[model samples]
Target: MTFAISKTASQIAPFRVMKILAQAKALQAQGRDIIHMEIGEPDFASPSCVHQAAQNAAEQGLTHYTATLGLPALREKLAQFYDGFYHAKVNAEQLVITPGSSSALQLVLTAILNPGEQVLMADPTYPCNRQFVHLLHGEVYSVPVTADSQYQLTLDHLKQHWNPQIKAVMVASPANPTGTLIEQAELLKMAQFLAQRDTYFIVDEIYQGLVYERPAESILAHQNLPQNVVVINSFSKFFGMTGWRLGWCVVPEHLIDVLDRLGQNLYLSAPTLSQYGALAVLESDALTELEQRRQIFQQRRNRLYAAMQSAGFTLKTLPQGAFYLYWDVSEYTQDSERFCAALLQQTGVAITPGTDFGKEAGKSHVRLAYTNDRIEEAVQRIQGFVEQYR
Candidate 1:
């Protein structure tokens, strides 16, 4: 007898970057020296303070499940963090802790969308976002974004795409793949527009602390954060706590109870020890250490950006934040998936294909993450690979 699979499960595409990573590991097991440039994970370890905190929690036997909404103390600390870091007035009552930002996205989408409603986002977005919408049986309306707009959605895009079926708009700042940011003024305007239409506005700020050009700001930085706005962030990228799987979000007060109930039903609670570690990292010295790591990432970004351009790659935009550089490889190959596969197989350099991000312009593009410490050597390998085609 054959088991039936739901169409939603069947239609969901695999995250191609992880597939590349798995293949790279397989090669590594055979003694191949792989230089990873594919995944968007920080190379730095979590701060000593965070480790100490987690150890203390374990020693004290604080392993039981916290509240479904997470530890009240952690929530309160995050509120203080927003107040001090972004000067954004966030009440502790408005925040909810989740296993990761991915779970936060799932919660927010589940709460807002009815079956068949739509979410409007840029075409080349974080691939999992579209999948999250699909998991909820919601539709996605992707607006094609080009380098002309810095690979971000503008108010005009929203205005043109708005339909009665569109229930929310989701976007990321210091966006994945491109590492571009939506201008603050434009973000505000879009938020106001969505608020007027009674549509939810979800902003992904998981890469907020990795910005290079200027101090990072949040949507909550606006004097009065529009009630329609929901901000999602993670400790994974900024604090080097990816393995801990801790993240939080700030939502409107009215949705707090809804999220709390959902949280109770979903996973019950986030990891208790991880929450304790997160609480420790919110302190001043830990933040300063993370800031120094950000500087190191900026240095790597600068080196890789110049080297790739010197290698005759077309980098349309100078990534302002995040560790990714999405470059056009159309000059040599239109098939980014094949290009990435060949690059990994031939040179032991792993990078993500544009197809993993979206269909529009994906075949012509590829995303290289600067998270690996051996980036200089990776650059040399990539340069040699490009020369073979040239």
Candidate 2:
């Protein structure tokens, strides 16, 4: 007998970036030269030290499974990395190393939220984040974040959106798509608002160490560990280890036991090799390599911003961190999917459509990811496409 998909699955939409990326790949497989800029992954290699660690671990035959939560050593090292970067009082017991930050978030949502419970986030944030929430049978609510809000969460927005049904607030500093960090004052305000309501406050800091605008403005810098905050981080972005799929979540001590149980039942264990690679990336000279990558992306952002502005697209918000420029394409076309698709076919430049982020997203906006292998070439191509559109 044939089975039907769950009603919940219907609510979850496909990530538009993945679809565009697939189309670009299919065209390239037929030998078309498409300037790649749709995906946000770093166009760099993991440092040699990371690879060497993986090699050493493999040589020592250390691939057997460990604690489902994570290896104690990796968890401790991750805490050390956090303590060094965030200067927060963190212990290994407050952390869980999942396969990726994505899974870590899923575990948190699953552990804390019941069916129909709502989690609040800024609209036009990350696509997969909403999907993950839906997969956990939780409702993901979007609070409209505008350029006025710096595309980050604001306390006013929270007050308007908050309710008893709301179980958590998912805030991403250096958020995906927008690449904007929440200002310090706004963060403190948000922390206070959520703290009073006794709702969960989750911070996605995967892009923490890569920040260019400010160095150490973590939410962890402002709160006690018991204040209902779970900090999510990753080896991707800053460390250039997307494929390694290693990321961690710092949970409150109360949730630690439940997460450990869920981690055991759900994930079994994170990859041993990736853990080894992450350990080296976190505690070695690999920081130098990561810093060099930041310089390259920072330069690319400057170039892309100038080029996009010259091409008639208005920079709605000059991104302070991350590698994207969220530009308003209203004058060019209201339909971002069609606009981006036409640009690719016409100029061989593939860019992500803004609609991937939220419902309000598909209209008159485009997210151009400038950190690619042919970053210079991509900008030149984007300049040509923008000129033609103008």
Candidate 3:
């Protein structure tokens, strides 16, 4: 007898990048040379300091459960991080550590949304966000964003799309796929508007430290942060700690207890060893090492950007942060998924189809991650593939 699947489980779309990655691995196992440009994980290992810290924790028998809200010292360090990095004043009391930014997002959405309440976010966003909302039986209202706005949501977009059903507005800086940022003035305007409507503003800052052109700032930089604002961040990206499965979120003071209780039940606590490692990375030496890696990523971005443009790919916006280039592949194929699969099979170059992100403009686009060190080789392969179509 077949078991029935829940609607949430059935309707949640698969993250297509992982599928492509699996296929890419299959080819690699068969001795095919694959140039990976699909996954967003940084190629670098976690800082030496973090490694040392984790070892120390393990040796000291610090593997026991931490407070559900996380180690007080780690939370306090993150608060100081905001002050030193963004000149933003954050209270340690407002922070909650979780297994990953994914968990942080889950807690925030669960705390604020009732079933059927809506979340407004840009289309072509990180694919999992809509799934997160769907998991809670909430609705996602996607606003189609384009290159004209640098693929970011503007205050005007929010004003036009606002509806009574929308309980929250979520956006990411150095956003996934596109690697673009929301303009600061526009972000501020949108935040104030949401505050007036008693709606929550959720900012995803997982890629905060990898910015290229400008210094990254937290929304808390505002002298008076709105009570409804929530900021989610992680050690996964810039800190090169993806495997550590650690992240944190800063919420309004009023929601601290709600998140603490929710975290206690849902996660019990983030990984204790990972928490200790995170503490080491927050120090000045580790930060300096991360900065050097940022420069390397910037260099990779520059090299790949020019090569892709030279290969006749249409890149509408130069990525400001993160390590992705969402380029239009419509000139070659209208079906990005098919294009990606064929490209992988034929050229052994793996990249993600835009369909993984959203419906609008997805078929015409593809996202290439520059996270791997083989970018130059990948572009050489991509150039040859494009030339065949041309």
How far out, in Å, is residue 307 in model 1? 0.6
Residue-level lDDT tens digits of model 2 in 247-270: 889888889999888989987888
Candidate 2, poorest ten consecutive residues by summed lDDT: 217-226
- lDDT (Cα) of model 2: 0.82
- In model 3, where do residues sit more than 4 Å from their true spots? none
Query: What lDDT score is found at residue 336 in candidate 3?
Result: 93
> Model 1: runs farther than 4 Å from truth?
none
The regions of model 2 sitting more than 4 angstroms off are 223-226, 386-390
- CA lDDT, every model vs. true structure: 0.92, 0.82, 0.91
- Model 1 lDDT per residue over 125-230, tens place: 9999999999989999999999999999999998888988999999999999899998888999999999999999999999998999799889898987689999
lDDT of 1: 0.92
Question: What tens-digit string does per-residue lDDT give for candidate 3 at 50-156?
Answer: 88999999999999999999999999999998999989999998889999999999999999999999999998999999999999999999999999988888899
User: Native-vs-model 3 lDDT?
Assistant: 0.91
Q: Pick the lDDT winner.
A: 1
- Rank the candidate models, highest lDDT first: 1, 3, 2
Measured over all alpha carbons after superposition, the RMSD of each candidate to the real structure, in angstroms, is: 1.0, 1.7, 1.1
Per-prediction TM-score, please? Answer: 0.98, 0.95, 0.98
For residue 97, give model 1's deviation from the true position in Å: 0.5
Better of 2 and 3 by TM-score: 3
